[model samples]
Target: MPPRPSTKKPNSNPLKKKGPENKFQRQQQPQQHSKEEETPFDNPTNTIPLSLQQLLLNVFQSALVPNTSTSQDGKQDASQRDAIEDEGQLDVKPLIQTIKSHLYNRDFDSAFTDANEELLRAYALRWSASRTLGYAGVFKAVLGILSGDKERRGAGGQIVCIGGGAGAEIVALAGVWRDIVALPTDDMNGEEGEGEGEGRMELKVTAVDIADWSGVIRRLDGAIRSSKVSGSKRHPAPLLPDGKRDKFSVTFQKADVLSLPEGELKSLYGQGTVMVTLMFTLNELFSTSMAKATAFLLRTTDVVEPGTLLLVVDSPGSYSSLSLGKSEEKVERKYPMKFLLDHTLLSVAEGKWEKVLSQDSRWWRRDAARLRYEVGEGAGLEDMRFQVHLYKRL
Candidate 1:
């Protein structure tokens, strides 16, 4: 004490200002932190094989003109087929307008004819593909969160698409499963490569729709099987092992999903992880009748097992107008799609469904410059802004 008194002050530092005035300044200084580590789902890859898109266009054209080619050889009939296909091509603008009018008039039965579906595919396949990317991103984000806990890594499950007969969900789910199986991981010994396929699980997609889209789904499945990993600048080589591509099965059921009996609904998922999806489908059901939609969901709550994941994606700010009563006593009201979905799923029981993720709007776009094929002016190959809600059955 005597030495300190003679030499220097005990609580003073020359490097830092010594006063009550600097007390707040010290707390305001930025703290040093180590850089954060990146996770597998940090950046969800949205690229699809160029071959898939090209094949899709071909399929659409062929479906639109079933008898375009009678020749046996491809080279011998290439020009003939092209001319016939071009002639068979319907004007995208008017076709889509007609379809929209039918939909608006609440005549869904007339809008989904075989020819109309093909035309719709030609006009909207790219948009659907873009939406698939959005869905895959959400799937990865959810799976990534579940992966943090060792016991909850069984997030890989069967994908049941309520009205995904157009085949976007098929492609998206298959690609996600392929990437997940091919992703490398560390083993118990802290080594990489061995964890690849350690959690390998087969994906089964059940597509339930009111239309006969089985033919289209089959063609898409064939295309995906034949799609090779093109090591291009835009789509780099995939992580799949040599001679291995995505292996999955798709089952299409042509029926009104909402009208399916509880036993049939329960039969859709046979154990294992089950992720049900309603992509661009729920709004239509609500537009038809909110009462029916509500009843269907409540029935689902009673039928489905726990640990099920329900994923809903639709246009942002989707609204439906309801008219009740007859003649002069009619009353009409407009309701948002998200509000109705939340009310139905979350309010069914005390804890029937737990909302895992919700996004009001997320933009998904396809860069025209990266496309391998030429796009027509009125093809409607634009971007999509969608809302996504993910729920878990408790």
Candidate 2:
């Protein structure tokens, strides 16, 4: 029995077959062959060049410059001030060339990294400036509230700053309050016979952001404390000749703009008149989902009392999309300025927020000029466009 030859024969084909030969299988084989013929670079990871990496790094380093103010005597010196003032004054040709070179060198990863840093820095600086201006305006409005004449102030107000990174914008707003509203009162000597400068004016500000970003938060906290200490030491006299101290209140808290906590909102605002600002932060929200972003805005608006103001400042350039490139072929797509504006405007409208004021594009160009180059030619002012909108609650 053991010596008997084995009866089993090896099967010629192990693969499943519908028939001896099927057209579908034959067709699939050629398609597979054609796919194999394609170059490895067709894969996304392989196609990205090394040059892009370097470009991204350079852009990011450029953005880190403004934060340097923290290390430099805690106050901007004349040179630093001049540089900041002239931010958007220079040509960005050098920056473009540097980025182009990095891309040509196939360092895409580095280029993207650097670009993200630069974008964050740019956003920080822009928010700082805009916050300063708006704060000044709001402070003036607050003064009107204190003024015996009713027409100057349009109801007492509260301000909520969203994505209030590092609190630079908030600090700047506080500075404006100290200067225009606080200092002026201190200058006036209290004397009933002299005149009626005898009352305190108060304004409240609340800053909110999603992440801890402890470094920024700490720096801001220190700056605020220092400002207050400096003001107290420098001005012993009351703002009003009547020996009254004008009160300016500021509260900083961690919060998620997408899903705001109701208790935090009530504590910060307390039914007082409100104004909201989403400075350079809407883009992050937009990146997640435009519909979701709009919903967040709508929800925020719904929570606030009627007649509140919402200020939105965002870059209107196809820069992000251009960087991401095309979806199908991985080719770069040049997005026109118009396309960016249309997209941003559509989002705002979708949120059901009506635009009260929209600034010209030149402001963004000015901001870009402020960017300084540490590694490569910095992005020029002309390469960017920003639109600021003030939407009043209906």
Q: State the C-alpha lDDT per candidate.
A: 0.55, 0.40
Q: Give the root-mean-square deviation of each candidate in angstroms.
A: 15.4, 24.0
Q: Which 10-residue window in model 1 sums to the lowest lDDT? A: 1-10
Q: List candidate 1 segments past 4 Å from native.
A: 1-106, 113-117, 123-126, 143-156, 183-199, 228-247, 324-327, 373-377
Misplaced by over 4 Å in model 2 are: 1-156, 184-200, 225-246, 261-269, 318-354, 364-385
Q: What's the lDDT for residue 318 in model 1?
A: 84
lDDT, candidate 2, 309-374, per-residue tens: 676655543133343446675764454433343344335334434443343232211222322323
lDDT of 1 by residue, 309-331 (tens): 78887777789888889989999
Q: What is the lDDT of residue 170 in candidate 2?
A: 58
